[model samples]
Every structure is written in structure tokens, then in C-alpha cells.
Target: MKYLTIFSLLAFITLFSSSCDNDFNINDDWADITVVYGLLDPAADTNWIRVQRAYLGEAAASASYGEPDSVYYDTTAISVYLEAYSRGADGSLGTPVNTIFLKPDFTSRKLDDGIYSTDDFRLYRTTETIEEDKTYKLVVEKSNAKHPEASSITEIVGIQQSSNSGFRFVLPNPNVIAARTFNGNLKWYQSDQAEIYEVDVYFYYKEVNRQTGAVEHLVQKLDYTTIEGAQIPADPFETIDVDGSPNNIYTLLASNLPELKPNTLRFFKSFTVIIWAGGEDLAKYIDLNRPTEGVNNSKPEFPDIENGTGLFSSRTSIMLDEVAMSQQMATTYYLSSTLCEKGFAIVTSGDTCYCERIPGIGPERVCD
Candidate 1:
């Protein structure tokens, strides 16, 4: 999920506000200047939109946003909404398919108070299905204001699936023993509108009670590896590279599982691969918010919103779960000299031996 913390951005703006003092000159009349943030994704059942007012001056800027109600708006005073536009049967643009109000929902949020806020941050939410090949716009308005305080638009271009749809497994090749080690790459074809990609592997396993000789299925889902915020330029047609090293995979299991105990036994289960991707707006938002490239120390202006500040974007993720280990590889967890040395527990189900780790992998079982 994308976090839209304005306190940090406010602090950052404060740091550079002096240099660009004239850009944010506060009027004595205290006319409201709104700050908005939201990232839309069809994959999510509930979408969130965060709205806050921009503050200025040394004293207000330095104040911790963690304090209750310091950086949020009154639900009665503000209204947030979303509009979806899609093409019709004729393939020509038509009227908005839907216009929905984002309802208020409050939950404890760790925000940036120059550090980060830990209070309940208020947000507007909707269950609208943000569809593919559609355009979405967000509008925020104050009850007393004549016009929307903030507004932004984003295009929802769906992510293009790879030939294998991002989950490709490297099964044990009959001729290559080494094939038993490597878990193939998690790959995807980039969307024409996507600019950032993330890949991760989840290894799931179980722990056992040696004393009772009872099995505890689904103990942990270890994040074996992650490739975060990878930049992909040009048309995203070719396959993308994700970590697929066997050594690292073993190391992760060994480190998490640790030394075997007489009181416990663990078993290896299935593994999952996930690919998270973001659209062009998210990429631009990242570039604008990510640390500066050089010593220049200036911040880039955010461009998506109009007559206001912050971001409006879209994202999506794909997952492949319960991928089974090759028989050769599963067997090695117990009998292979190389894998046995890693401290993985050897457990038996009937007559078959499977490797297990502890602390453990997310409580999801890997198939034997």
C-alpha cells in the first residue's frame, strides 16, 4: 500500500520553504489551502483518500502532527469523491460510468509528526471497483467553499500480463542437479503505463511438536527476498529480472528456522511469488518524493494535482502461491549434505522426509 504522509512532506517543504518562500506565502486572511493524497487500484476492495490542510510558519510547521487532530479535518466540513469514466461499446469516450462519495473512516495511523503520526488518521474510503481502461478523478470540497478545494485525475491502464503471467518456476531438470537449487524468477511484462515494479518470494512452512509427535501445519510465510521499486523504462514487453538465487533462499530458511530442537520439528511447505506494480503517476510521485539525487538539496514540484498539493495515482499486484518444491529439492532438505548443514529440521509424514524451518515462515503450508 502507498502511504500518503503529509507531515514529512510538510517538513520537507518547510526545509525548502525558506528558499522558495514566495511560492507558499500565507495570506493574512487564512484562506484554506488543501493537501490531498490517494492511490487508486482496482485490485483493492477498499480505496482510501487522505485529505489535510496545508500549514505554514515556523511554529506551526515545527509542531508535532502526532498530537490528536493536529493535521486532520472535521468530517462535517469536508467531502471527498471519485468519478470513473470509461469508453463505450462504440470505443468512443462516454459519460462518467459512476460518481461516488468517499465515506469517512477513522483508524489509528502512524503519520509524520516531523517524525511520524501515531494518532487515528481520518480517511475517506470507497468500495467502487476502479476498472481497467478507465480514468478516475478525485474531488475534495469544503462545505462553505464555492469550488473544490483540491482535484486530480489519473488513468487506470491495466498491467499487462507476462506469457507466464509473472509466475515462472524452474522445476528440477533431469540432467542438472543444480536445477534442484534454483527457484525460477518471478517475472512480468511491464504495462505501458507502469513505471515501478516490485517482486517478492514468500516461503511457507510448518513446525512440529516433537514431544507429542503432533504436527503443526502452517507456521510461517518468510519473505525470502524482495526487489522493491525497480525502475523499468521503455515498453514493458521483455521479461523483468527478479532474485532467484538458491543460496539466498537456503540462507533465509536456515536463518529463520535456526538450530533444530529436541522439543520441536518443522516442515517445509509451499512457496509463493508476487509482483506489485504501479502506474506512471506513482512513478512520478516517487521521483518527486524520493531523496534528491545530488547535493543541490532542492525538492521537485509534484505535478498531478491542480490548484492544490499532493498525489493521485494507481497500483496493482499479482500473486502465485503454493508452488511445490521439486522432489529432488524436497528430498535434499533431509538427505543432501549441502542442505542438511543449513540447520533445517528434518520431519517425517508417513515415510517421506520434508525440510522445515521455524519462527517461522508465514503460517502457510508448502506442498510436499
Candidate 2:
């Protein structure tokens, strides 16, 4: 009887051990989620390069999807994130400075069935002025209840100066209106459409008062378009005499007059011909794998004064996105590079000087 008791006790201990080993909870229908990521850079071939794949799964639900007699998966959720940054010295992916949150507008961002879709295409914009020369990286991540992993960023984007003024001269005449300095003739030829947009030369310049010694600044920029409304047509360009719809160039000569010092004050020191490219033109380099519109979309690539690749060089083929590219109607240099290279000279038919500073005769200044 004692021997029988010992055997029974040993069996009981074995049963307890087996029960304890079954501590793991069975999960049902747990599987890795699918996601796709890509990159777009204007400098490169202008196409979105697919980075890699990632999966998210729970530890308890380690088994593949479609398990028989398995416990139901309580978690039904997923998420994705794409990060962008400049490479640090170590090269192990520096701090993520710029990132793109690629979730549809007002929609649930859940990557199910492992079929994720997104064109990680994006054009970089510096909240703080992006220096003329700098490089940045773009990273993407996707996660879910079942699969939580990441992918490497094999792509890098660089910000390059679009143009070189060589010698960006401003109207030297002190009496010249601030705006007149920007007035210039604009001519362009494109296959999709041939039309003139704003003929204005955009630039960033610091202004310091000659009398008060107070420093000031004047900067204006916008992506341009010749698709009507965005700019004054060539017909109007002739009317401005400066030759562009934004007749503002001529107005610059007449706009608010600033104190004058021929040699002291400076205009357009770091001057770059800001080719105001509108979204229509910039669409050339956009990674269309994803959808973009209005302000949310990447701004179009505008023509500027950069050498070899300035607006004239890239006039035919514009940067659409990483996944797309286009060509200009004619590679032939159309815009007068000569005019862009040299500063504006307001020519009043008879006056020998490039421009004349007509003293303000507005009603506001008619006092004795």
C-alpha cells in the first residue's frame, strides 16, 4: 500500500508540473502586418526609392495567422511612422529632426493584411532657413500589435543652392524705389504649356538704415505657375516694360521710398534668383505614390539662376517627385541669362542712367 501511495504521489507531482508549463495564453489570428515605404529626392533621379519592410506581432501570438482552436487576438491595432534627418558623425542614423507623418486625412491608419501602401515621397522645407548647402536623411517605421519592427534608410537628400548670381547688382541709384530693383523681362517655353509667369527675381537681403543704423530685411518667395492668375501673362509683361505679369517690378521703383546712401546701404547681398515655381511646375518632382494637394503637397520646383541647372537648364525637365520626372519644352536657354546675371537698370528712354528716381509726388507728400 505504501508503494502504491508513493507512485500516486509521483503522478500527482507530474500532473502539477504539466499544468504549470501551460502558463502561456493561446492567441488566435495573430499575424505580421504589412507596410511599404519609399523616398523621393529632387537631386537624385527624382523618384521614390522603396526602403524596406516591417512586421508587428505580439509575443503571446508568436504563431502565424490562421491557427486552429487558438485564442482570439484581443488587440486589433497598427501604426506607421517615417523619420527624416541629417546624418551624424557616428553614421548609425542621427537624431530624427524631420519626419513625415503619412496617415490619410481623418482616416484610421491601420496596416492590416500586411498590405501597407505609401509613397514616402517628400520635398524638404526648412522651418529655419535651410542653408545653401546641407544634407538630410529620411527614415520610415511601421508597427502593429503582432509585428513591431523597423527598416533602414538607404536614401539621403541634400539641399543645394539653386543658383549663383555671380554678381547680383541692385539698382545703385539711391533714389530708385526698392521694388524697381526686381523688375526684369521674363520669357519661357514649355511643352505641357508655354506661357510667362512672374518675371520677378526673388532674393533674400538684409537692409540697414543709412541714417538710423538699424538693420532691416526684405524677403519674398512663392512657388510660381503660368497656369493663369498666378502671374501676369507675357502680353502684360510688355505693358510693365520690365516684361512680366507681376508689374510689381516697375512698382518697386515707385513703391515706398527708403532713405538713400549710394555706397552705404546694401541690396541683395546673398541674392539668389528665387524662381517662384508654382505647384503646377513643382508637381514634376513629387512622389505621386502618395496623394498631395493645395498647401499639404510638395511645392513645385521653380526656375532660378543656378548655373548649368538653373531655371533655364531645368526649364524643360522639372523635378516632379522621386518617382516621376519631366523635360522642358526646349533645353535651349530661353530666359536672358545676361539679364539675370546683371542687376536691373531702369531705362527711361532718354535718361542715360539705368533708371530714374522720380521724386514722390503722391498726394500724401504735397505739403509746403
Candidate 3:
């Protein structure tokens, strides 16, 4: 599965270019810099890592980026693997568990057209199940003796649980009424080894074709919030809340939903919440790479991988589905002046209320 951390590699290139002045040399001696990017997740059946070399020459870096040979190393030139270690009760690494070797994966997924070479793109992957109770160390070995090996270690983000109650919505439930005025809170049990958290809220609905009588289910996502530098609590039962305002949901729907169509009828359904937690190394990497402001904009480099200029971390996600809306909130979609014109309909207690405009009358609300 594709992970969001993959974009960090692109951001790294952008940041490097912006930091360079016009006087900087474009044709400097090539440095044997290996770029490593990986995110381990215990929930995934497989994990993949991207390993590439930084190139420099007479040509502009952008010009060479699209060339397969310029950015990618031959498959046989490098070896990648992970060494598992037992994590002790005191949070210290114990004896080695097992080593998992990764093979170059050319299929499974395709690369999008970009500045990077998409023709020969590849990723190293392993199907071995990742365990949450252990720590994983990534090791990248190069056949070229001149380049040093790149390595980094990370612990899984969340603890293993039998139930799906690890993450939950604490406020604005039973129905999200007056979302603009509703204070929202998303709570989750403190996940082990998690340093940063991100929450996403999705609004689901159905659109019926006025002519064909066919229905299409659709969903719109709103990035609720991100919580950084979170500390694991002493009590496992203790929870952490990510603050948010539901009013944004209304605004998001109003702005993003397609323009009202005369041949379409829209009905609001339910909401889903997804939470993501990142390991300490991943959190630190993001923190260090964030855009700087003010007169002094210089930032320190954050290459968590040893003998390389990239990151190897861990992340996991949890989802809560089908959170129902309150009856009043459902009614508001059809009655509210701001949303009624958007062709919203409400269905509650076996009754349906559709808001629409009549040619002779100004506007009309019909119930069936």
C-alpha cells in the first residue's frame, strides 16, 4: 500500500533547491549520497522502502532527474533488509530476533509522471509480518565499496488490540448539529511509540440521478487537525484529544460539493474518522523540514538514516466508520437557508424532505 511519507523525498529535493543561491555551482563533484525513504507499519501485510542515489553533473539536476540511470541504482548493485530486535520492558533494544531481506519490486504499483524517472522506478519490499512487540532496524548495503551502508531503527506506532476501540470520537456525536458552533474533540488511547498524530474526517452522501433513478455514493474528506510532540501517558487507559471545530465541516461541504444540478438529488448520510500516528523519527523529520519564517529562514538537516541523507521511520492508522448524524442535524440540511439551495434532502422516521425551487414560487420544501 502507498503511504504518505513517500512525498517527503520530493519535499527534500525542493527544500535543497530553494536553499541554494544563484552563485552555487551546478556541476560539483558527485557526493556518494544515498537517499533512503521507508515507513514500517505492523498493520500492513507488506512494507516497501525506496532507495536511490543523489546525482550531480554538468547538466541541471532537474534535467537528469527524469533519466532512469541518473536517479536509480542497478537492482544487483545494492541489498536491503531489516533486522528485528526484541524491545525490552525498559524500552531498550534486546538480542536480535530475525533478519528480513527485501527484494526490488517493479510491479504492484506504478509511479506517477513527475520530474523523477517513472520508467525504471522501483521499491524494495518484504512480505514478512511486522510485529508491534519488537523494534526494526533497516539496513541498506551497497556493492560499491566507496559508499557506506545506510541504516536506521524504529518501533511500531500502536499497541496490538483485540477490539477496534483504540481511536474514537468524543464530542459532536449522536448528530453533528450546528457544526459551525459545535466544539469537537477526537480522542484515542495513547499509542505506544507514537510521537505525532493526524486526524481526517470524511462526510459521506448519496446522489440520485433525477432521470435514470440511479444512486451514487460519494465522500468528501476534511483534514481535521494534527497533534505533534505527543507524549505517551503512564496510564494506558488515558486518552488524548485532538481539538477541532465542526463548523469547518459545513464550510468544507459548501465549498467542495459540486454545484447543485437540476437532474440530481443529494442526501447526507454519515461521517467517518481516520487517525494516523507516526514514530518518533518520522515526527522529528517532519518538524525539521517544515518551512521556516521570519528574517532567518535557515533550518538544520534531518537525515535520520546513518551514512545517508534520508529517513526510515514507522506509522500506523485507525478508522472509525458510520458515525450517524443527529435527527436535528439531518433536518437542518433540508431546512437551513444556507444549505437548502444546495439541493440537500433529509430522510428520518420513514419521511423524506427535499428542498428545491419552484418556477412560480420563490423556493419550496416538499416532504413525502
Candidate 4:
């Protein structure tokens, strides 16, 4: 198994540096070996019990998810995560070094089970210079298939030059550069104190079709203890410039989303992104009425592969600001154009490994 993780990480860096104070520490506890002798928690069915917190990257936001009515808002995905670490030296788990992966815009990269949190372990984000108290470590791993591989549930917080909770943020959280690539651009991650809040973005187009693999998404009913009273927005916040500024980017309107009738080139490629940082003074604005921008533009059911069979996909919702350190406020949603390779066998592309075969083959490996 990869030379047993390189000989147990070279016998733990040759027995903890061999001499430096002849010391040894990193036993946040739990380690019995299974992947050839790992640590943290490893009884070895695969691993279980995940969901931890403790993070505070401050602020940065965005959102988008169409049709709050007529059904479609599950926001699916979010099984395990909280692997942030700043120091723990060896307690294993939680090792991104500086750490930061909160994800917003509804968490679209799969793993959005609502920002995930079982409890404790959350150094989530914090590193301007790294001083404060030092400590650092928040690890929790489960879900490879999830069965009981155990290990990873360690927390050792510290660092508070100015921290009331875990503090750190940033990831592909701002992604939406362009799904089908028409008029797109939505990026977030700029928080000094989060100053101004009044951001709301939502776009939708699900139920495409790729011959009929069957698909239709978006039913995120709204939970997490009512999501901070259903999304802040009483008005009184405003600090997110994007710097390159211009308009922020908004364009879509087939009569402002006539239930999404695109001409199909891939107009909406099964999408999702619902963000409302602090909410915008709520008079009730979730794309106003919703269809996702449009004035002269056009493409909903349009072009979907000439207009049929694509398997549909979409989700993006972000309402950040729990400040980590633990839980109480978290929601993630992100799932971009994934035919995942329509069951694998006839075709799958994105540069191979969509995987399936092995029935007889010597090795053609062929699969788009």
C-alpha cells in the first residue's frame, strides 16, 4: 500500500527527529494500525463518525439556487470534513498546514452535508502570522465508503491574538466562472471584518437530459436551526467589492426564468449556487421572481444538447458566518455539471478514470 505510506512516514521522521530534545508528541490518542498501521482512530472497517468544527475565516460570500417553490432545493452532499490544522506536530489528521476549506456558494464540489459538524475539532481558519497561543489541530475523517476505519477526532485549539472561535476561510468557494460558459463570473473570499452584507445570488436550470439517465435537483428546504432566522437581511451591511468591479455579473432572462426553457447548448448545465451572506435588507429578493438574469440573452431549454437528453444537474447556496470554532451555522451546496460519466461503459470524459470495466480486458483502459 504505497510502501506502507512510505514506511510509516519514515518511521515518523526517524522517530521524531531522533534527537531534538529527544522528544515525542502527537498522540492526540487513538492509533491501532490498519492501513499498515495508521493512527487517530483505526479499527478499520473504513472509518466513521465525522463532522467537526472550529473555524473563522471571517467573512466572504455569495449565493444562487432557483425556484424556492415548485420543488427543487435538496442541496445534497456533505458527509465528512474538518481537516484543518495549524500545528499538532504529529497528532495526525487535520493537516492542511495553514488550513481553510469552508466552501460557500452552496458547497458544489460534493461534501456539502450542510458544512458538516459532529462537534469539537475545528481550527477551521486563522493565520495572519500565526502567533496568539499556537496549539492548532482539528481532524476528523470518515466516509471513503464509511464503515469504521476510525481514527481522527483530535482538537487542540489555541491562537487568539483576536479569536472568539476558529478562524480561517477560502477554497474554490467562489467558483462559477462559467458552467456552460456564457455570461458568468461569481467569486468570493474577501473578508476583513466582512463589513458590508447585502449579497444575494441565485441561478437555476436543472432537469436537462442525456438520453434519460434521469435527473432533477434543488430542494434544500432550509434547516440548520432555521438558518439564522431564515437569512439575516434586515439591511445594514455592505463590504464586498471584488476590486476589478464593474457589475459583478448578471445575465439571464427567458422572461426571467419561464420555468427554464433554454435553447440548449448546455445552457444551465444542471446548476446551483444560493448565497445570502447577511442577506440584503430582505423585502424578499431571491432573484426577485427568478429565472436567472436575461434581457437580450436566451438559452434555457434552448440548445440542453440541441434540446434533450443530458441528465441535468445544479446547486449552489451560501449563507456563511458561523465563525467556526464549532457549529450552529453552516450550509454548503455545490454540484457542477456532472454526468459523472453516465454509469460508465460506453463513454465518459474529462480525461479517463470515470471507471467501470474489468470484465475480461487485458487493458485498453479506453473511456472518455
Candidate 5:
């Protein structure tokens, strides 16, 4: 069986540029495909929709995309809007609670070897929160005669709460940096309707100004090296266990902190863990993107948008905030030998660090 190509199939719910327009066109193609991509998260403060047209023609001989107009759309030719609706008692659609007009925003990114270019894109965004239990519809209209208007619907999924749903740090002595190494378990209950889960931890710290005694509580979001691409099981009682080790947490912090100025000493604050649960649409999209094991290597069909391409899905997130650090973590990890070698000023304390004793005082510096 030949693989059915869906534009933006590999980009998840976001438009990460699917390569439908290669320079060389080996096959004859005359159809202009309308591609749309968006993922709705109720926890987010804003949402964005990306629209693009698939180009089919003889590929250019040169590597360069000669002109900007070849890829992007004329802003005046496109119109986008998002309509929100709440469900009724009988499971029917109610009147739209709000209608948001999306504005056109052009963005660009730098590629490898200093190559700068803009994508064939017209993005529409709104600063409205997509609350749980409400359904959303995205409508895209175009002035072009050939491309038909498109629409997609997504029902926002609520989060599943767990009684003991948080990361439990296993620092035997919170005061020692060496012992402060992570030896704990991050746990969360599975959502019955969610197929995917993402676990993220943000490390909080403080950066103080030496001259004026000003302070800033900086946060470092830790990327999961081992906890990525995790899925929630069908059994809701099965808790997801993210094995946390000292190396897992500290290695990430050490690599990211040096950029903040290795020479400057910063005190470690608390950490927060964020858990995200994805809706059914997200699960279908994930399964469709996976490589087939057969000789055909064909992709599965998983488009949710009606009269267009790509997914419109919902996700909910919960954050465990203001988590405190143990004493061992403060003395060792905060001002450890590794950090000291990198020019972080040595902090002198009288039994307890000044920040801990006074609460939110930040890091203590030399001569203060």
C-alpha cells in the first residue's frame, strides 16, 4: 500500500514546516493543498493558528528559496477567527460565548550556517484562555478562488487530579550538596481520557546585583532527559513513576546555569513541577506519526480538522509550585565545588545561610 501523505503530519499539533515543496518535483502534481495547524491548551494565556498552502511544481535547481513571496501568503487575502461554545445539558452545542479575531503576524528564524529565511505562513493569534468543558472552532477563509475555506473543532479536556501527585525528593541531608543529589520519585495519576503525559521541572534561584544590592529570583526550566515521550496507560489507577536521580537534575542545572554568568554566584531557590495531560486528538496524532513496521512504511490517517489538514486538540496542565529546597541542597548543590570553580563567589554563613534565615532574602555575597 502506498503511503498517504498528509501535510504537516510529522509536526505534531504545531506547524513545524512540513517539506511538501521540495526544490525537485519528481512527480506531476497540480493540486494546491490547504494546510492548517494548531493545538489548544486551556492553561495557556494565548493561542496561535498557522495557515499555509502546499506548493506543487517543478523544483528549483538552486538550493536557495529565491524569493520570500514564493512561500508566504499575502496578508490581505486571508481571514481567521476562533469561536468558543459550551456544551448543553443534552450534549448539544450552545451559542458561541466569544468570538476572537486573529491578527496576522509574520515571524522568521535563522537556519544552519547563518541562513535566514521566513516560512510560507500567515499566523493568527488571540490572548484568550481556552477553559475546560468548552469547545472551540477555528475558521479560516481566503480570498483566493482556488482554495476553499476550512474549519476544525476541539473539545477542551480537563485535568485529572491525584491526591499525592507531586515529586518527592530523596535528599537524605538537604544541607549537603553531594547528598542533595536527586534520589526521589516523581509520581502522578493517569488521566482516563488522556493518552500522553509530559513532566517538567523548573529550578528557581536568585541573582543579586553586587553594586546596588538588587536581587532577582530567576527560574531554570529543566528538560526531561529520561522522562520524555511518556504515555499514560488505559488503567487510571496505574501511577506514572519518573525515576529521579541526582545526576538527572543536577547535570541539567550545571549545563544551563553557566550561561547566566559562571563568575557570578547565585543562590538556589525552590523548584516547581508541571504536569501536562493531552486530549484524544493528541493521542491519535501521535499514533499516526509513528513509523509503520511493514515494508510499505505508510503513515496512518489522523487528521481532525474538517475540510483542511492537521490537528486541533486540547491539553490541560497542573503545576506544583513553591517547592522548598532541603538544607543539604542549599549548602552543596547551590554553592558546590563545581560551581565554585566556575567563578561563583563563595558564600559565608553563620550556621544557616542568610537567605534561608530571613526567607526570600536571596544569596549572600562577599563583604555583605
Candidate 6:
């Protein structure tokens, strides 16, 4: 499910325009420049690629942006396909495994309303499963032979079970007591072809309105940590670690969550962990295109597709849900003197003990 917005496409145009001439020109010689953006994910049921043409005409670029002909090719005008190749012992591409022809998709996914035409929003797609161990090459050929075919090769970010590098939560185990002083390493195995990783943690809870007896489920997310440009180890099963502290979770909750209302009772539900991995090429593209500061505002181009502009890479994400803390840890933290002030409670043996504050008085526990 990789797609691009009109703004990204415009940025690509700007990047190519800058590389071609010192001064911006609205009326340059007509050239056939294909724009392609795709990210292969082994976990996805279907993969999609966005293909479009960059236009430079005598008239203003913005004036023609709304015209379908200016940004998109006719369905029959181009053919898109993916070639699979296995890597040899020497790291060279082996014989072709298979070729996957992509069909033009016009209606599965909709585009947001913008300056660009949406009448026939197009994307090329294939339902074939992408293999994590194989290399993929995307090729786009135009009916007009004068235009050179655009192509790019990438390796899929491998985190599937078959790859023997499936992501797993190593620390803060389901039964671990996550006390306030708990300090451990949040760890997971690195995937092949992955260079960048991002982890997010979600905290789920239920809030009950004491006055109305209404319950509301709530969740808060924390961008726990990120590992960028990690060099892949010779061993594909290498594990990576980041600081994991229970105090950090408490601090994040205190800072982001709203203070409890006088008549509210909150109960801790569970936690969820999500990790995202980006392929090496995608990481390089992101690094090269990131904004620069000071007098050097120009950025280096990162178009991977030959004879065209835009990115073609790989990315994948995994989620571990229903992560739980030991009952002792849950009560020690959620019902502690500090967090209890925020109307936290615990349910045990069909009974509930919640914190309550009376007017002109300190906090007290009320059991029901």
C-alpha cells in the first residue's frame, strides 16, 4: 500500500528541474520523463506502483496540472512489470525466477482532491506474493519506443517467519513487573535488507464516569525509539537493543494524558508494540532528501529509477498486541501514590478500588 501525494510529485519535479538547469524555466524542450514511486512489502497481499509522466510545456506547469493528460498516461500507453531474481553466492543476480505483469488500477484506491486531476487516478498493481529473499526489479515500458524504459531494483525488507528473522519483543515480557525503577533493554532481531527501524508503544485503558456509570475506552501512543542507518551484521539473526525504562512510560503518560476528572475512574487495560523496518535503499533516499539548513539548502537527488525520477524501495511493519505487565507491577504503578492521584484503579475478584478526592481533603480509596 505505497502511494504518493501530489506534493511529493511536485517536489520530484523541482528536484529534477534544479538538476537540469541553473535557472527555473517553464518552457523547456519537451522531454519524456517518467515518474515512479513504489515500495515493496513482503507482508502485503497486493503491491502497487504509481506511474506518471512529468510535463514541461510553454504554458505554466500549474495551469496544466489539473488536466489528466498532463500528469497521467493512458491505460494502454504503458506496461508495468516486476522481475524476480535470486542472488548468487557471489552476490550477483541469478537467473530470472518469474515476471509479474502489473495491471492498471483505476478504482481500487481513491486519491484526495487536489490540483491534480482525479477523474482517472491510476496505479499499477499485482496480487503475487513478494518473496523476502529475492531481488525485485520494476520496469515501466512506454508504447512509444522513443522513450527509454524506466527500471529500478530493490531487495525486500525481510521480517517474515520463513526468513527466520521475525520480529519479537524481548524485554518487558508479558509477565514482567514493570516497576517505576525498572530499567531494561527493549530488543528485537534485525531483518535482512533493513537499515532503519522505528518502534511505537500504545497504552490502552478504560475510563468510567462515576456519576453516569458510562465507560469509555481510550488509548495513547508513544514514539518509543528509532534506530537509523544500522549496519547489517554478517549474521542475519543479530539482535538490536534500545533503552527501555518504565519511568519513561510513566513520564510520557503524565505529560500527554489529560488529568482525571473528579468523577472518573480509569483502569489499565494493556499495551501494544509496533515496529517498522525500512530497506537500505529507502533509508538512503530518506537521508539524501532530508532538508538541509543554513546557507546550504540544496539537497542531493535520490531518484533510483534509471531514466526516470522518484523512489522504488521496500518497507514492512509488525505489531505485537495484548502485551501485559505482571499484576504486582500493574498495581504498583497504576495505583501508586503518584499515578493514583489521576483517578487510577484496579479490578480484582469482581471488586474495584479507585482513588477519590473530597473537597478540602486529600485522596482516599473507595471500593465497590
Question: Candidate 2 — which residues are off by over 4 angstroms?
Answer: 1-39, 44-182, 188-201, 222-246, 250-271, 275-368
How many clashes in candidate 5? 11
C-alpha TM-scores of all predictions: 0.65, 0.25, 0.78, 0.17, 0.60, 0.78
The TM-score of candidate 6 is: 0.78
Cα deviation of 275, candidate 4, in Å: 5.9
For candidate 5, write residues 1-368 as lDDT tens digits: 23334444545434434444345547775654557778876667777777765555466523445444554557777688888888798978778998878877656323343332355444767777666657788887778878777888877755533333422222222335444333334665554345576667787778766556677777778765322244444455566777675556666766776465422446666677677777778867877787778788777576676666777777667666666554555455544433433323326554322222223653332334
lDDT of each: 0.63, 0.32, 0.76, 0.27, 0.61, 0.79
Candidate number achieving the greatest lDDT relative to the actual structure? 6
Worst 10 residues of 2 by lDDT: 321-330
Better of 3 and 6 by TM-score: 3
Name model 5 segments beyond 4 Å from true: 1-25, 59-69, 85-100, 106-122, 144-146, 159-184, 188-193, 205-219, 225-243, 254-267, 283-298, 306-308, 327-368
Select the stronger candidate by lDDT from 4 and 5. Answer: 5
Against the true structure, candidate 5 has what lDDT? 0.61
Q: Indicate the residue-level lDDT of 44 in model 3.
A: 84
- Checking candidate 6 for backbone clashes, the offending pairs are none
lDDT of predicted model 3:
0.76
Collision count for each candidate, in order: 13, 44, 4, 98, 11, 0
* Residue pairs that clash (backbone atoms under 3 angstroms), model 3: 175-325, 175-326, 179-247, 180-247
> Model 4, residue 296: displacement in angstroms?
42
Error of 2 at 89 (Å): 44
Give a tens-digit lDDT track for model 6, residues 1-368: 13568778889999998888886665767888889999999989999999998988776778897889888988788899999999899999877799999999998999899878897788999999999889999999889999898999998887764244475545545344443122324666777778888878888999999899999999988787778854444565666777665677777777778877768888888887788898877888878877777898788678688999999999888776777754546765654445657777887778888766656765566679
Return the number of clashes found in candidate 3.
4
Candidate 2, residues 1-368, lDDT tens digits: the string is 99999999999999999999986755546343223333333333323222222233464344523441232111113233345555567755557765544332212232244322322222212222222122323322333423444333323212232222111122311233333222233333222121222323334445555458777666544333233333433442122122343333324422333444442343343223322222232233232333776777665543321111111111222221111001220111111222221222221244312222234631111111
Predicted structure with the largest TM-score when compared to the true one: 3
